[model samples]
Target: MKILLHNLTRFGDLLQSQPALAELAGQGHRVAVACLENFAGAAALLPEAEVILPLPGSRFLAGLDGDWRQALAAMDGYVRHVKEVFDPDAAVNLTPALAARLLARRLCGEAVRGFSLDAHGFRHESSLWAAFLEASSAARGLSPFNVVDLFRKAAGVGLGPGRFALRRPEAPALEAARLALADRAPEGAAGYVGFQLGASATARQWPPDAFARLGEGLWQGLGVLPVLLGGPGEKALAAAYRETCRAPSADLVGATDLPALAATLCHLKLLVTNDTGTLHLAAGLGLPSLSIFLATAQPFDTGPYREGCLCLEPDMPCHPCPFGLPCPIGHACRRAIGPDTVLGAATTFLAGGGFPAGGYPGARAWLSGFDRAGFMDMTSLSGHGETARAVWLRLSRRVLRQFLDEEPLAPAGQERFALPAAVHDPLAEQLAQSADLLRLLAGHAGLAGRNPAMKDRFLATWERIRGLWTASPQLGAVGRLWQRDAQRAEPDLPSLIARIERYAALVAAFADRLTRR
Candidate 1:
C-alpha cells in the first residue's frame, strides 16, 4: 500500500505524527510524506519512504493572508502538485489549517484516514484538519484521540499499545547522531536520558530552571547522563540549562532536524519532556519517556501510548488551562509534579533496566470520584464570608442579565475586584460569592458571554454552571469534553437544570448590586 501523509501543522506536530506513519512503513507499506516547505527537511528521517514531496510555497500558501480566492489557488496548487507526482492509496492530513483541509478535501475526496487527537475544540487548527478528514470520509476518530487506536482503526492494523512503529530517522543518521554524541552519553545499560527543553511557545514550557533542577538530580541520584535535545529554536534554552546546572550534560538543541533528533533519541534510555512533540517522537522510537503536563491539557488523551512513559501532571480545574495565558494559580499541573517526583521514577527505571511504575502515585490523588462532594462542600462553607460575597456577585449578574437581556460576563484579569473584606453584611457576602461563581461560570463557557436560548434547557443550565466567559460576541464555544458530548441528552437532566437556575438567580442578584455601584 502506498500512503501519502500530509502534515502542515507546526514542526512538533509533524514530528509527533512520525510514529503513526512509521507503523505503516513497518508493515512494509510504501509511505510517501507530503509536507509543507518548512517540514520537508524532516524527509531525511524516513528512509523507508518511497518518495518525499515538498509542496512549493505550500507552507507560505497555507499561511497566505488573502481572501478565500487566493487561499483556494494555493490549495489548488497543492492538489495539482500531489496529482502530478504520484497517487497513493490514501492521504492522511495531520494539519487542520483551512488550506490543508481544502487540499485534503480535493485530493482524498471523502474517506480520509489518519490521527485526529483534538478532543477539545480549543485547538482550532487540528479540529479543522480532523473536520476535513471527516468530510473526506477519512476521519478514524477524535485525535490526539489515540495514535495506536487511530492506526488500528484506519489501517485495520493494530500498532498495539505504546508509540506506533512510525518512521524514525534513517539508520545511518541514527548511527551518526549516536556517534556524534558518544562522548556525552553514559556508558553501559544504565542508558542515557534525553531532556528536551524547546517548545513552540513559552506557554507550553515549564520554566527552564525546572528542567535544570531535574537534570541536576538525574546526574547526582541516578547517574543518568542527560542529553538536552531541541531544535534550532531551543538552543538558547538548552544552553541556558547547561550553564545553570551544577551537573554536566550534553546540549544538542538547535543542532538537529526532526530525523536527526529522532536518530539521536533512538539511542536514549528514556526521554523526559514537557508535553512537546519530542515526547511523541521518543514514544515512536519505543523509548521510555516522562511527560510533564500543565493546565487543562490531560495526558489521558494526548500522553504517549507507551505504557512505560510516565505522565506527571496535577489535577487542577484550570489545567490544560487556556494556552498563552498564564494560569491564575501559577499552573498547578506543572508545579505539583516536582523534580523529586519525576527523578524518583526516572531513577527507578534506570536502575530497574528501563521501566518506571505505572503512572504517578500523586495523580491518583486527584481522581474525580475521590472528590465527589469536595467542591460542593467547599462551596457550602458558611464561614467563608468571602464565599458569600462571590455568590452575591454572581446573583447580581444573573438577575441583571434577566432584566436587561444582557450578559455581564467580562474578560479575566490578574486581579478581579472582591469585596473590601468578607463581612457579615448580606449584600457584601452575596457580592463576593457571586463574583467567584460568575468567574467559575465564565471559565465553563470559555467565551465572554452567556448562552443564547437553546432547545434543551439542560444545556442552558450547563451554560450557567460551567460557562467560562472569554469576553465579546455571545456564542457557544465548547471546551474539549463538552464539545464531544454537547449533542447528547443531559446525563442528569433534572439536577443539571436545577444547578443552572440556582446559579442564574445568584448571578442576577449579584449583578444588581454592581450596577447600582
Candidate 2:
C-alpha cells in the first residue's frame, strides 16, 4: 500500500515524527511526506521516504505577500500533484491545526487519520491520537506517553522500542564540526558539555546567569568546557552569556546548520538544553542529554526519546501548565527548578549513575522517561507501574491536604468523604481512615487522567482487578496461592494498580454507608 504523511509543524516536531515514518516504511508500504518548505531542507534527511513534497504550508498561504487567488491557485496546483503524481491509499496528518485539517481533505487518499473537514464544513477527528492531541494542550499533565508515540498512534501504526532513523550527514560534516570544536576549545581543556541556551517559548528559557554558574562549576570540578548551541534566534542571548561568563567557553549558537550540528553533537560528552528541537536532534545522534522542562512542558509527553538522558521538572503545583497565557506567578516552574537543582542532576548523569533508586522524593530527583525506543519506555518514574497513584499521593499532599483533613461526619449524615476519626467507636475510626484514603486516591486520579492511554488502561485494568479480587474469596482452596503469586517479585503491575484504585472506590462507597447510619 502507498501512504502519504503530512506534518506541517516546525522542525523539532518534524524530527519527532521520524520514528512513525520508520514504522510506516517498516510495514512494507511505499511512503511519501508532504511538509512545509521551511522544513524541506530537514525533510531531505528522511531515509525511509521515497518522496518529499515541500508544499507551501497553510500558514504561509494565509500570510501570503500577494494576491489570495494566486496563492489559492498555487495550493490547488500542489493538490493536483498529489492526485496525479503520488496518489496514496491512505493519508495521515500528525498536525492538529484547523487549516491542516482542511488540507488533509484535499490530499489523494481513501482514508485519513487526523483532522478532516466534512461535507457540511464541520471539522472532525475519529482516531484516538486525534482525541489525545485535542485534549493535550489543556490536559497537558495527563499524558503518560510521549509526543512521538502519540504521533505514531495517530497514524494507526504500531509502537515499540522502534529505531528513529534520521539521514546521516557525510563524514566531512563531522570532520568540519570537530575542527570547529577543537579551534574553539581553550588550550588544555577537556571535552565539552553542550549548553543549549534557548527554547521555543520565553517561559521555557533558563536564565543566562544560571547557565554561566553551572558552566563555571562544571569547568572547575570536571574540567569540561561549555559549548553553547542554538539557532540564530539565540545569538543575542548567547553573546550576553559569553560576555558575562566567568569561565571561558565556546559559543556556536548560530554557527552550524543541521548536518554540521549533528557532527558537533558527536564530540560532546553531554548536552544540557531546554526542551527544544536540539534535544531531539541529539537523541537521533545518540548523544547523552539533560533536558530542563520549565513552564508548561513535562517530560512525560516530550522528554528526549532515549535512554541515558536525564530530565529535571519542578514539582510546582501550577507547573506542567498549558502555557496558554502569560504566567501569573512569574514562571514559578523555572524559579523552582533552579540552577542548583539542574547542577545536581547534571553531576549525577556525568558521574555515570542512573536516577536515584526510586527517583527523588519530590522536586529534587532526576526526572525520567521509560526510554521506549521511539517516544517512551514507561509512563512515570513510579518504577515500572508499581503504583503511579502512590507517587501521585506523595506529590499532591499540599494540594489535597485541605480535603484530606475534613472532619468526619456524625453516625448519621449525608457526608461520604467527611468521616472524622472517633475517639471511642472503632467503626467511626475505620470510616474516617477510609475517607482520608479516598481523598488521596482522588488526587492521584487527577494526574493519571491526563494521558488518555493511561486512563484507558487504568479503567480497563480496574475492572479486571475488581473481578479477580471479588473472585478471590470464592476460591475456597486456592485463594492463598493466588495471593502468594501476586506477592512475588514479578507481580502483576496492572492488577496491583487496579486494586489500589478499587481500594479508593470501595472506601468512598463504605464512607457513604457510614454517613447514612
**Candidate maximizing TM-score:** 2
Residue 127 local lDDT, model 1: 25
Candidate 2 RMSD to the correct structure: 13.5
| Residue 346 lDDT in candidate 2 | 70
lDDT of 2: 0.65
Model 2 agreement with the true structure over 41-61: per-residue lDDT tens digits? 777777888888887766456
Pick out the ten consecutive residues of candidate 1 with the lowest summed lDDT: 368-377
Query: Model 1, which residues run further than 4 Å from truth?
Result: 1-3, 15-31, 43-49, 56-59, 62-75, 88-90, 108-144, 147-163, 168-171, 185-191, 315-317, 323-326, 354-517
lDDT to native, each model: 0.54, 0.65
**lDDT, candidate 2, at 290:** 79
Displacement of residue 429 (Cα, Å) in model 1 is 28
Off by over 4 Å in 2: 58-66, 83-85, 353-517
lDDT by residue (322-428, candidate 1, tens digit) is: 43455666545555666666676778767785433345534321110001211101111112224333333333223422322223444233323344332334434
